[model samples]
Structure formats: structure tokens, C-alpha cells
Target: MTKKKLNFCFKGSRDYIHGTDIFNELKNCFNDSLNYENTMLDLSFHGIAKKKLDIVEDNATDAKVVVKFYDTNDDKKTYYLVENKDDIVCRYDYAENKIVELSKIDLDLGKINLNKDTSYSLIENIVALNKSLLENMFKEAFGKWYFTRLQLKKIPLNYYLIRLEFKSNFNFKLTKTEIFLDNESLGFIYFSLV
Candidate 1:
């Protein structure tokens, strides 16, 4: 069998998992796919829910992580990793492995500072009401998959990106991963199943 690469670099609140656990969790998420739709769920929420996620987990670390986010819609599929400091933003290109200096932007304080804390929820809830259900959903879709990149937006946002690079171009499943911003539900990552 050909070798496949499964790499995941989670930023924000979910970065503290043991390397083994992270690998195992990714394996499980891809193995138990047959009965995901029938798993038992018991979930409830009180807000309008700014975002919804199909699967999620709450056992991560608080370390600084670098996530790589690629724009699938782009013809070149340009990957982006934003770094902001002192009101300056720099964008990196994965393919060329360098920063496109022309894309740099300088701001003078108004909104969206990478060093300041802002209050906004990117994801509200993980779709599965419980852990087992979440596990099953992940497995069924990612059992034979690998990752290509981890996309991250501007700094201080408390969220990054995960890019799946599968083993082959065969039957695959589409799913979402729950992301958070400092213990609060932030948003969902719709995994590309290609």
C-alpha cells in the first residue's frame, strides 16, 4: 500500500493533546463511519447559535500553534498563514514558500487587531450531542485520509485550519470539525473530502 500523511496542527484551545492521542483520535475519526447517523445524542443550547458544527471535541491545549489555511476556490489553491503585529499584517505563500510582500498591509488602529482580544464566536456547538457520536462521524469520513496543510487566519483570533490529504481518489465523506475561541463555541470547519 502507498504511504499516506496525516498531519494536524490545531491552534487556539485545542492544541494541547499528546501527539499519540491526536494521531489516535484522527484514526478513530476515520474508522467508525458506518453507524454515525444512528448514534445516540443528547444535546441542548440556549442561544441563537452563531455557527453549527457536525463533530467536535474539548480536550486540547493552550499552546501557540501555526495553522495553514488554503483557499480551495483559488485556481492556484493559494495557502495563507497570516502574521500580524504592531498593526502590520504579512501573508505567506505555501507553494513558493515565501511571503508575497505586495500583500502586506499597515493599519493605524480602528478594528481587528491581532494583539487585542475581541469577542466573537466562530462556532457555537459541535453537532454530535455526545462524544461517541462525534467519534463515529469523524471515523466514517476520515478513516483513510491524510492532511496536506493547516490553514490559519490572522493572529489573536483563537482559530486555525486543517487541510485533509487523502490516500487516494476513491469514495470519501464530507464533514465539519468544531472549533472554539477561548472555551466558547467559535465555528465549524467543513472538511474537503476530495
Candidate 2:
């Protein structure tokens, strides 16, 4: 297997882990395909979430994290990750490895930030997130695709983006994550899924 170079470095703090859990508890929001070592997760629980995710914001000693997200449409699937900040957003496309600076509109700040909370659990949140949420969201977005200009042709693909909030703690790792549409006109699709 080809090795992937992770950009972020360790913050150099001792972690406090308990129980028989084999994995350490610091992480960011990402697809299951992101199986990297030296990562942590802050599991937040609420709503129709699928799979366990690390709370992405306001937790790590240094406010920084490596986050990953994915999108699949018909024959193609793309995965992305970014080392980001609340004030700035960037995305790395897996196919191109190109970094794109994201604007405020690309991220639905008004809707996602308000719903998610501050605190999180280390384990319960992961388990609480279920598959139904994914199916429901995709189901809702499929029918309501907004027509958009794609490659000089009008295509209806609901582009999505995920935001991560990492904690500013020394040892405890937490990541808060939320997904938003590329365009606000598609906002209904998200709530429709929920």
C-alpha cells in the first residue's frame, strides 16, 4: 500500500485513557476509510447521526486537527482532508491534492453551529450515531438536487461540505463536526434528511 503523508504534527501532551479500549480517544470527523494511527476522537451524541465521529472543535490543547470528508456520486467518489481553523477553511481534494480555500457560503455556519453542543462523550457518542442517518440524508438530498452549472453543463449534484470544531485542551481530544451544502438553496435538503 502506498503511504499517505499526514501534515499535522503531535502537540506533545500525555493522554489519559481508561478501560480496555484499545484505541486512544482523540480524533476529528471523517469517513471510516480514514484509519490512521496517532489520531483521537471526541464522540458527540445527538440527532440522527451515523457512525462514531470525533468532535472537531474547541478541545485539543492547541486548537488544530486533521479532518477528512467524503463525497460519492454515481461512478466517482472523492475524499478530502484539511488542517483548518474556525476563522479559515481549506479543503484538499484526494484526486488532485489541491487545496481550495472555502468561503463562508460553502459552509452553512448559521444552521450547523447552532444545533451542535459544546460537551461530548468519549465512547457513547460513537455508538449512538447510526446508519439510518446516512440513508435518510442521502434519500432526502437525492430528489431535491438543485440544478447547477457543472463543466459547462447543467448538472444536479448536491455538493456537501463538512466542518470540524476542535477543542483547546492539553490532553483531552474533542472534535465537533457538521455538514453543510455547497449552496444555501440546498438547505432544505439537509433538514429534509433530518
Candidate 3:
């Protein structure tokens, strides 16, 4: 019996917004409605597992946004707020780490400035947002397996790369998966089952 290795890698840019930056922008947009210090204290107390803000600029005057927050609480809940232009379309709370569509919550949104520059914080947020997706995709491609190593690197042209290696006892073939965002090519997933 021989031991085999499965390698999965994704390379490209998703242009994700930094968690802290977006949180600050939200605080500013809401004015006195959102208390900065108190919110920060609550987040510190509960701990932040993941945060991501994805903004899509439709035209010169219109934009759509999807903001998500995952906290390290006992419930492991995920909260999402979706906004189109200046109006919040809907809000959802996913409890127990399950993706369920629930009732809506009201949130007022104002003008938000999107940052296009790439930074380490943005990379970390992107990783946090996609970690579960990557795991699910890996399982779909090669069945359930535990990864042995993980590596992340910042590359040129505002792109980030991630690699995950898993040890296996079965041999398979090479496979490739393309990751996209709004019909645009964002990255790719390459893996070899061996």
C-alpha cells in the first residue's frame, strides 16, 4: 500500500473589501445611528470569525453590496446584509452555521467609498470568506479528506494564491475548476487526486 497526495490551489484576485475598512465605512455611513465604540466592544467580546464586503458597481450612480459577518459565539451564526444603491434590499441571519434564508432586517445605507487597492487585510478577509467554500468544493471533487498542509501567498497584480495539500490512499486524475464572480473570471482551482 502506498500513500498519495492531493493538491488543490487557487490563483487570482477577487477584489474583496477589507473587514475593518468596511466596518468603518458602515459606521460613518450610518452617522450617529451606529455607535462605533460600542460595536467595537461587542465585536471584541464575541470575537469575529469572518467578515466580507462585496460591492458591485453597476453604473456611475448605482451599486449593489453584500456584507457578511460571522462571529465566534456559541451559535456560530452568520449575519448578512444586502444593499442596492442606498436601500437595503434584505437581511438574513443564518444560525448554527447553516445557510438558511430567514426574515428581513432594516438597515439604512448611505454613500460608501470602495477601495481598490490590495492589502494584506483584504487577502486575509478573502481567505476567511472562502475557506468553507474551498473545503466544500474539495469534498465534492475528491470526496471527504483532511488536508495536511495549507499555504497562502500574495502575488503580483493584486492577486493572491492558496494551496492545500491532502494525504490520501487512493489514486485519481488531475482536475481543474474555475472560480468566477459576476460572469468575470476571478480565479481557478487546480487539483490532482493521486
**Candidate number achieving the greatest TM-score relative to the actual structure:** 1
- Candidate 3: misplaced stretches above 4 Å? 1-14, 35-80, 83-194
Per-candidate TM equals: 0.21, 0.17, 0.19
RMSD of each: 21.2, 18.7, 21.0
lDDT score, candidate 1, position 62: 23
- Could you arrange the candidates by TM-score from highest to lowest? 1, 3, 2
The order of the candidates by lDDT, greatest first, is 3, 1, 2
Candidate 1 runs further than 4 Å off: 1-135, 138-142, 148-153, 157-172, 184-194
Candidates 1 and 3 compared by lDDT, better number: 3
lDDT of 1 by residue, 1-194 (tens): 11222333332333222222232333344444313222211111111111111222221132121222222332221111111122212222221111111111222211111222222222211111111222333456544322222222211223432111112222444333333344433333333333
Error of 3 at 165 (Å): 27
Where does candidate 3 clash, by residue pair? none
Top lDDT model: 3
Question: What clash count does candidate 1 reach?
Answer: 19
Q: After superposition, how far is residue 171 of candidate 3 from its true place, in Å?
A: 25
Better of 2 and 3 by lDDT: 3
Rate residue 85 of model 3 by lDDT: 26
lDDT of 2: 0.22
> Mind giving the per-residue lDDT tens digits that candidate 3 earns over 12-122?
221222233343454344444433222211111111112232233222121222222222232221222322223222332213122111111111211111123223343
